[model samples]
Target: MTSDTTRTEPVASPTDRLRRLVARTEVVLWDFDGPICRLFSGHPAPGVAGGLVDWLETRGLRGLLTEAERHTADPQVVLRAVDRAGLGRGVAAELEERLTQEELRATATAMPTAWADPLIRTWTALGVRLAVASNNSPRVIGAYLAGRGLADCFGPHIYGRDAALHRLKPDPYHLHRALNALTAAPAAALLIGDSPVDHEAARRAGVTFLGYARNARKARLLADAGARDVIGSLEPLLRVVRERGPGSAPRPQQHLPHH
Candidate 1:
């Protein structure tokens, strides 16, 4: 299904982007990283939405994170563990703290190509609840949001590690957690993200996937994998939610809102 999804004259606009995105479904189950947040690792780092990821892997590091941590994947929990691991290489505990401080001073965590705040606001305004299903440490996710002043964008529904030790994305555990949290269901929900990993995770979990074209090649791969929809912008996806109406998408993944 990884074919290029080409649609000329997108029936979407900046002002009505959220409205259009909301048309296709209800709750918007979103991915982090290239979709909502941007990583601000320095120098050799290619920066968010660029080849920073490739840069990291090229450095023998999966990311600013450690090995066991990269395997963790879910930003919601991985960083939290890494923060405590003090066990990994690359970033010494002291150095991690120092760099994290530096990152906080500059990056706002939102992708230049994304408008996470409005997307959330529109969904909420449409009476649609939002939930996070990431593969990182809750602490890091929390810190990233707070540091960027985006902690309120998702309210308290952020699910991270410490919540589910062995349950992460592509395993469908986070999906289950989101359902429980939002009281949502898989069939009725839609997940939007920018990578094959996100596509695989949603497919394995049984939720509809909307491959955001953050990476053209990855987007093609996701479409080939059977994502229900694909788009380069959040506007169209929001439109999709509105079309789906209330209770039409997957339910929340877990219970309780963190912080």
Candidate 2:
């Protein structure tokens, strides 16, 4: 007689999940600020946000932002608030330009995320397409990539904030744009990011997401946000990629017809 108890399959470890994700990803959409490098590492976001607020005050438009928004450390918050208020094009353009200038300055001291460079290069060598899907300025992303001599890894496929501040992450506009440009379907792509907004955006875009957290708090945040594959470092991913051997290539997918 057979035993009545049923057997259960063991859950895949984090590294195994990462390996499976990497193996199936034909295109990688990367968030600029956190996963690539700390864009405001030395520059500090609070100072930048304060400067934007100060600029508005100088124009006697401090009343445009609520108290919470005025003090928020994210410059994008300020810009979005101003835009939502239906501020004219001149004000919005100037504010975006100012933020861009600040980002360009921050590039000089931006700290690279360890293992990010090699992972990008390795993925490129394996014939996986790469593009930057970020909320930061494309100009700033370009500068950072160029400085690291990894600009060619992404080419001109960097998508970021522009005049349309409303299209930022959590909106999925940039991710959609990258998918369209790369001619890849959502099912064949993966996005690696740090924030809940990034996870939400990827979910909307129908792309798989991997969370890259440098600390426990971030890992916890991602896990709480429903990210199943969160890693404290990119090293594990790098190890998996290296283990795939130099001759391996991305899994085959039917190319979407270019419009």
Candidate 3:
């Protein structure tokens, strides 16, 4: 006789895979600049970088940079160049301090990324340990989080730019520090970031990387960088949170005889 039993299993979709990833994640390492907020939105980053260059020029150190370095608006790149120029500890310290002060000044007008706040709160409510790993200064990050009332959510787990600009993302230094602080396995952590640098660092640290692309071009770039998954919106993640509730694992699949 033919069997007349049937079974149902969860059909995995993109969102399903994302949900599964989150369900297995013990910690979430967030990259501050894009994933969290546009920390340099209101205050133009190029202006800050230009200011750094001008400071060096004031000290008669303008010849220290190549024309390209002086023209670049990226502060981190400029800082790295300064370090590679072997400007000594005093110069590095001063530049880093100046950058930190500019970041702090920008924090007051930093623009929040859409859906990031809710997603963070949802993740926190689900008992996920959260940390910030970024190239920005920790003091600036702490200040921004405090302003957003998210300081207690992450506590002292915020990791950011250290003494050496060369040790930033794509080097896995900050990611390692965050992992150590959480005492969480790399396999059980998820990193959400916007740049390829973040992707590279996560790969080196053996953590699952989720690319948060704000635009189609950025999403394409992340995919080109070999990011397994890229998300342009957090709405799907929010939906998953509502469906699964908090601290719940994915339902196990079941099988039965076919008719």
Query: Who wins the TM-score comparison?
Result: 2
lDDT by candidate, in order shown? 0.56, 0.91, 0.86
Q: Least lDDT summed over 10 consecutive residues: which range in candidate 3?
A: 250-259
Model 3: residues with Cα > 4 Å off, grouped in runs: 1-12, 249-259
1 or 3: which has the higher TM-score?
3
CA RMSD of each candidate after superposition: 9.7, 1.9, 8.1
- Give the alpha carbon lDDT tens digit for every residue of 1-259 in model 2: 8879989999999888888998888899999988999999999999999999999999999998999998999898998888888888888889999999999999999999999999999888878889999989999999999999999999999999987777878889999888888888898899999999899999998999999998888888899999988888899898998888766867656666332
The best-first sequence of candidates by TM-score reads 2, 3, 1
Clashing pairs in 2: none
Could you tell me the lDDT of residue 25 within candidate 1?
47
| Highest-lDDT candidate | 2
Candidate 1, residue 37: CA error in Å?
2.5
Q: Residue by residue across 119-195, what tens digits does model 1's lDDT show? A: 66656655667677765445556667676556776677776434333454666676667766666666656777777
Which has the better lDDT: candidate 1, or candidate 2?
2
Across residues 112-137, which tens digit of lDDT does each residue of candidate 3 receive? 99888888888777777889999999
| Model 2 poorest 10 in a row by lDDT | 250-259
